[model samples]
Target chain A: MGDFDFSIIAANWRFLAEGLRYTVQVTLTAMVGGILLGTLLALMRLASLWPLRWLAAAYINFFRSVPLVQVILAVYLILPLLLQFLTGRLIPIGADNSAYFTFTIFEAAYYAEIIRSGIQSIPRGQVAAGYALGFTYSQTMRLVVLPQAFRNMLPVLLTQTIVLFQDVSLVYAIGATDFFGAADKITQRDLRPVEMYTTVAVVYFVLCFALSRLVKYLQSRIAIIR
Target chain B: MNYHWDWLFFFQEADDGLMYYQWVLSGLGWTVAVSLTSLAIALLLGSAFGVLRTTPNRWLIAIGDTYVDVFRNIPLIVQLFLWFFVLPELVPRDIGLWMKQDLPYFVTAVIGLGLFTGARIAEQVKAGINSLSRGQRFAGLALGFTEWQTYRYVRLPMAYRIVLPALTSEAMNVYKNSAVTYSVGILELYFQYKQIIEKTSQVLEITIVITLAYFVVAFATNRLFAWIEQRSRVPGMIAGGQGGK
Candidate 1:
């Protein structure tokens, strides 16, 4: 209790910052890729055809129910093997590069639901009005419905992104050095569990807390826009 | 790497006197234990904090809001690591020793998962309470109920009904999130998967089995919650005006 050292964090702040860079990278990749893929899936779930609906539902349900750590592990092991079989050699996405696509694929399920709700929130008459104005199906979705849905879904999407950012820490299971994993490595080498874990926790708390506040603010502003 | 499927590996015995299938079951048993115990804690704390958030007093609401914000914002993996590693060091000397040496990993995982999930449930419960019409509160007051009494009787019951639908997802999340405990060294399903993979060539098979195990638990949870939701339907009330869900 007497000699808590703040100097370890200061000494290794650059290393930790590098890890934070990777964390933010994975998060942004997942966010952008997930939203695009999720929007497509959401449309499939709402498609008039039964097979599209079932396929989307099945994909969404399986991902939603499984533990993300397991998914990460699955990616670590199986993805390389899959690429090997597919391309005649392991294309070597390895644990680190794999984390990017792994998260994007997994998070698409959650984003699908959010995007589905967002798409649903748009009035049917808006789509009908688009069609009436000589718009095709994709045109209405691209021009009128999706933009409005994106705005309506912004806060929820951001909230889930906050969650995805927290989840990016789980790549530690595969020995990838995201922010949390970076702290873990430092803790291992320095034998400073207290300093390392506490710093990591504090950083996460601050980042997530700030994002949540932004969500609240945006939520109010978005609500007023309608 | 050439892949071969060996489904029969599940029937083989490990040195611990349990077969692979039984080991899988034991893993499942632990997963269920973690999920249920944490869920119990989450509901108790969640309801408390949620009610506090909805209270007319600013202090109470702030207290609840702070709790939710602190817990929810941090990842479960970090919280588990903190409770398992840092907390034991932070406590008083003797208690810290006990935590380090004597305390069970399972208990630590449960506490970590519980507090984390409780924060989420508190948000759900707060939303449930706030979504109620002002008339419900007025009716409780009109019935001569005090603030606490009103919450205990009128507001809570209907509020819980409204939130039941949402709680199903939370219930599933608790189970899914229990997998995070593997980082803290609990012998849950994922831990079992690691153990089995080390001993077998059926990595894909066992992975599939683990995925199925989770799917099965989730399926059962969904069915159970659906049954409860149906049975608890207030008949022209639960859907907030429409017929039963």
Candidate 2:
């Protein structure tokens, strides 16, 4: 305890900030990619086609049921072998692939469930109204249904973003220097576990608090629209 | 690169053939036991907080809000680390020293998972209670039930049924989240699997086994939750009262 110095934090702030940039970038990229993939899965599940429905259901069930850490680990371990064989090249993606793929696929599975539930929560009459107006099924979904469904989903999506943001820390396990990873290195180097961990916790708390407040604000705005 | 069928030999003893399957079984037992114990704690604490959040007292509401906020915002891994590592140090000197030395890793993991998931359950329960009709509470009071009795026998039972879906999801999530405790070195399935993989270099086989184990646990949980939901469902609430669709 006596050996610990607050001065070290003052000096290493830049290093921590650099780590924070990587962490935020990884989270944002994953959130965008995951939401896109998740939306596709949600649409596939909603589709009337049998094989697509089965495939979507299986994907959601398997991914949602398994632990995210396990998913991250499995992809980190196995993706390189599969991708390289398929591409016939030692693609640079796998070399630092841990950072990119882990966040994207893990967040995608969760977002798929979120979007599916959001779609289901929309009243059935809205779709009936679309059909009554002579719109085709796909046209109704695009024109009438999804807009309202997405509004209902806004709050849940924000909540899920916070969850994904928090999970970005796990990138460290597979060897990406995320915020937690940066703190881990410092802790190991300095042997000041308490101070280092507390700093990490404080950073996480601030970011998450801001996020929830934004969600609350959006909820009110959406309510006004309703 | 022909795979050997004799690979199964590594799992058995060379001569007398005593399979140490008992270790895997015991590990699974601990996993289930931990999950159940945590679920119990989560349900009990979540109920208490859920009720407190609705209490008339402003201070209790504030306390409940803060509890939910802190636990909900932080990542589970960070919370686990805090509970397992920093918490002991924060305790009063003698007890802190004792806890630091005396508490087993498994027990700590259970406590951490329970407290964290309990926070989530509290919000779900509170939301369920708020969604109930005010007339029911009025009726309970008119029937000469006290406040506590009104809550326990009247509001809570109905709220529990209403929140069955959310609560079931939370319980399943709690089971999955329990796996994170492996970070703290609890020999739950994942941690042990890691050790096995490192030793044998049979990553694919072992990972397949682990994934299947997780799926079975999840499937069984979903079935159980479905059964409970069916039993607790309101008499008239199925399919929004329009059956035979």
Q: Model 2, retained fraction of real contacts?
A: 0.39
Write candidate 2's Cα lDDT for B125-159 as tens digits. 89988888888888999999987898999999988
Worst 10 residues of 2 chain A by lDDT: A90-99
Candidate 2 regions exceeding 4 Å error are A1-5, A88-96, A121-144, B1-23, B237-245
What's the true lDDT of residue A101 in model 1?
Answer: 89
Give the per-residue Cα lDDT of candidate 1 at B21.
92
> Model 2 Cα RMSD, Å?
3.4
Pairs in clash, predicted candidate 1 = none
Put down candidate 1 lDDT per residue, A1-226, tens digits, no spaces. 5556899999999999999999999999999999989998999999999999999999999899899999998888888888888888857677889899899999999999999999999999999999999999999999999999999999999999999999999998889999999999999999888998999999999999999899999999999889
Give all candidates' CA lDDT scores. 0.91, 0.77
Candidate 1 C-alpha lDDT tens digits along B92-207: 98999999899999888898999999998999999999999999999999999999999999988888878886888899999899988988888899989878888885779999
- The best candidate by DockQ is 1
Q: After superposing candidate 1 on the true structure, give the runs of residues whose Cα lies further than 4 Å from its correct spot.
A: B238-245
> Residue B176, candidate 1: how far off, in angstroms?
0.5
TM-score for all models, in order of appearance? 0.97, 0.90
